[model samples]
Target: MRLLHTMLRVGDLDRSIAFYTDILGMKLLRRQDYPEGRFTLAFVGYQPESEGAVLELTHNWDTASYELGNGYGHIALGVPDAYAACEAIRAAGGKVVREAGPMKHGTTVIAFVDDPDGYKIELIQRD
Candidate 1:
């Protein structure tokens, strides 16, 4: 079966949305609020959800922060140029935790950036 989407619980929905959509150059595919569940979900990605996997940002009405426990790792995105992507992310007020460089023990260039909710996103350069 094909993979669907990755869900991340964000403390600030708006901030997270901006980070994914504005800073990372992703599109907000859809968003919905569940009043009864007291939560909201927003899907974002580079392409349509039907075409590829996307990211789901979940925001609970009562929760303002998350610990992001140890088990959670970073999400990875393929880019044309890791260096350029990192530079653009930094110019857009995004946090670049790791500078663009070749992966350890490998030649694949990569970089890391943190979202508004402190979620790490890995950028891998692709030919």
Candidate 2:
């Protein structure tokens, strides 16, 4: 079976949407509000859900923040140029926590950016 979407609980839906769509160049695939649950789920991705895995951003009406415990790790994205990606993300007002460069003890180029909810996204140069 193929993998599906990754769910991230965001505090501010609008802010998270902007970061993923505006800064990261992803599209808002779909969204629906669960009035009874007091939550909303918005899907974002580089391609349609039928073609590739996407992200699910869940916003709980009453929750403003998450601890993001140490067990969690950053999500990774393949890029043609990690350095250029970092630059573009920064130019778009995204926070680049690590500059693009060769990874530690390895030669693969990589960079990191943080989302509105403090989630790390790793950009790995593939070609």
Candidate 3:
């Protein structure tokens, strides 16, 4: 079976949406509010859900933050140029946690950025 989507609990739905859509250049594929659950889910991605995996941003109406315990790692995205992507993300008001460069003990170029909820996103240069 194919992978589906990764869910991230965000404190502010609008802020998270802007970070994924505006800062990361992803599209808001679909979104729905669960009134009974007091939560909302928004899916964002580079392509349609039928074509590729996407990110699901879930916002609980009463929760304003998450601890993001140490057990969690970062999400990775393939890019044409890690350096250029970092630059663009920085210019767009995104926080670049690490600058683009050769990875430690390896040659693959990579960089890291943080989302509104302090989740790390790794950008790896593929080609």
Candidate 4:
């Protein structure tokens, strides 16, 4: 079976959506509010959900933040140029936790940016 979307709990739904859509160049696929559960779910991606996996942003009405435990790693995105991606992310008001450079002990270039909710996104240079 194909993989689906990855879910992340965000403190502010609008801010998180702006980071993914405005900074990361992703589209807001869909969003729905669960009134009974006091939460909202918004989906975003580079393509249609049927074409590839997407991201699910969950906002709980009563929760302002979450502790990102050590178990959660960053989400990776393939880019034509890790350096350019880092620059663009920074220009778009994103936080670059790591500059673009060859991965430690490897030749592959990589960089990192943090979302509004402090979720890490890895940019990997691809041919």
Candidate 5:
């Protein structure tokens, strides 16, 4: 079966939306608020959801923060130029935890950036 979407609990919906959309160059594919559940779900991605998988940012009305236990790893996004992507993200006020460079024990270029809630996102360079 194919993967659908990755759900992340964010503290500030607006801030997280900005980071994912503006900084990462993703589009807000779809969004809906679950009033009964006291939460909102916003899906973001590089293109329309009909094209491929996307990310779901879930904002619980009562949660101001999340632990993000050690078991969770970072989400990765493919880029045409890792170095240039990192530079653009930085210029847009995104936090680049790791500079773009060759990956450890490998030649693939990669970089890391942090979201509003401290979730790590990896940028991998692909032809």
Candidate 6:
């Protein structure tokens, strides 16, 4: 079976959406509000959800922040050029926690950017 989506709890839905769509060049696949649960879910991805796995951003009406415990690792995205991708992300007002370069102990180039909710997203250069 194929993977569906990865869920992340975001404090600011609009900001998070902007980071993913505007900065990361992803599209908002779907969005829905749960009035009864006082929360909202927005799915986004590089392609149609039917064909690609997506990210689900969950915004709880009451939560303004999260701890981002150690249990969660960063999400990875394949890029034609990690350096170019990182530069674009920076130009788009995205913060690059790590500059694009050859990975430690390896040759694969990589970079990192953080989401509004503090989730780490890794950009890996594809050969």
lDDT (tens digit, per residue) of candidate 1 on 78-123 = 9999999999999999999999999999999999999998889999
Show where candidate 4 strays beyond 4 Å. none
lDDT of 4 by residue, 1-127 (tens): 9988999999999999999999999999999999999999999999999999999999999999999999999999999999999989999999999999999999999999999988899999999
How far residue 44's Cα lies from its native spot in candidate 1, in Å, is: 0.5
Writing each residue's lDDT as its tens digit, candidate 5 over 32-53 gives 9999999999999987777788
Screening candidate 2 with a backbone cut-off below 3 angstroms (N, C-alpha, C), the clashing residue pairs are none
The residue-by-residue lDDT of candidate 2 on 23-114, one tens digit each, is: 99999999999999999999999999999999999999999999999988999999999989998999999999999999899999999999
Work out the TM-score per prediction: 0.97, 0.98, 0.98, 0.98, 0.96, 0.98
Q: How many backbone clashes does candidate 1 have?
A: 0
lDDT score of residue 18 within candidate 4: 95
| True-structure lDDT of candidate 6 | 0.94
Per-residue alpha-carbon lDDT of candidate 6 for residues 1-56, written as tens digits (9 for 90 to 100): 99989999999999999999999999998899999999999999999888979999
- Identify the superior model by lDDT, candidate 4 or candidate 6: 4
lDDT of 2 at 123: 97
lDDT head-to-head 2 vs 6, winner: 2
Alpha-carbon RMSD of each model? 0.7, 0.6, 0.6, 0.6, 0.9, 0.7
- Kindly report which residue stretches of model 2 are placed more than 4 angstroms away from their true locations once superposed: none
| lDDT on C-alpha atoms for all candidate structures | 0.95, 0.97, 0.97, 0.96, 0.94, 0.94
